[model samples]
Target: MILGKCPYCDDGMIEVREKEVSGKKVKLYACSNAHWTTEDGEMFELRADASCDFRVWQNSLARYGKWLSYKDMKDLLNDESIEVELISKKFGKKTYYNKHISLNPEYGVSVIWD
Candidate 1:
């Protein structure tokens, strides 16, 4: 199934490819745009099989525009097709956790919060 658009180029199409990693074959679907290829965006993986029930995973990852807490990072990552990085920030004598989420940089969708 067509999971997502390239998000970088209008003419680009997301495609699936099979590659061997750690001696095991895996299926990967990712955007075909050069920018996405360079930045590693919109990528999904599933084990090779005759059939893969990946729609659920894909659907869950496609939701957006909601306030989410730190506990929802995993779902947010999947939803935005981005990775989350934890950084430590010091305020006065205390340390707080900060989350940096990378979304469409060109569109100003990326966010950072504590």
Candidate 2:
């Protein structure tokens, strides 16, 4: 499925593909020109012609114990001031807090947990 346009490259579109791992199916999202590979390091032919390396894991987009939808991810890519509630674990306890999420080309998605 096409999630949205790529923020890194002018002519790239973000696409999601499914792959089976450990007897389970998982989705991997990446830009059309992304040099992404499967979990086993197997590269996709469609992604071989690379211009951008924007890729993200499906589970990595989760916040507050819930996975974000494609639209939500798109919104996050567009807005820098978007804050998300995140659940943190410390001393066997769960704590919730809000922080702004940012997409770094070198670091992927991240938020200030500290």
RMSD of each: 11.8, 3.4
* TM-score of every prediction relative to native: 0.31, 0.73
All models: lDDT?
0.38, 0.68
| lDDT per residue as tens, model 2, 1-114 | 887888898999888767665566656677888764455544443345677888766666454564555765777667764577778777879998777777767655776555
Judging by lDDT against the true structure, name the best candidate. 2
Q: What is the lDDT of residue 106 in candidate 1?
A: 41
Against the correct fold, how does model 2 do in TM-score?
0.73
Clashing pairs in 1: none
Tell me the RMSD of model 1 versus the true structure.
11.8
Candidate 1 lowest-lDDT run of ten: 50-59
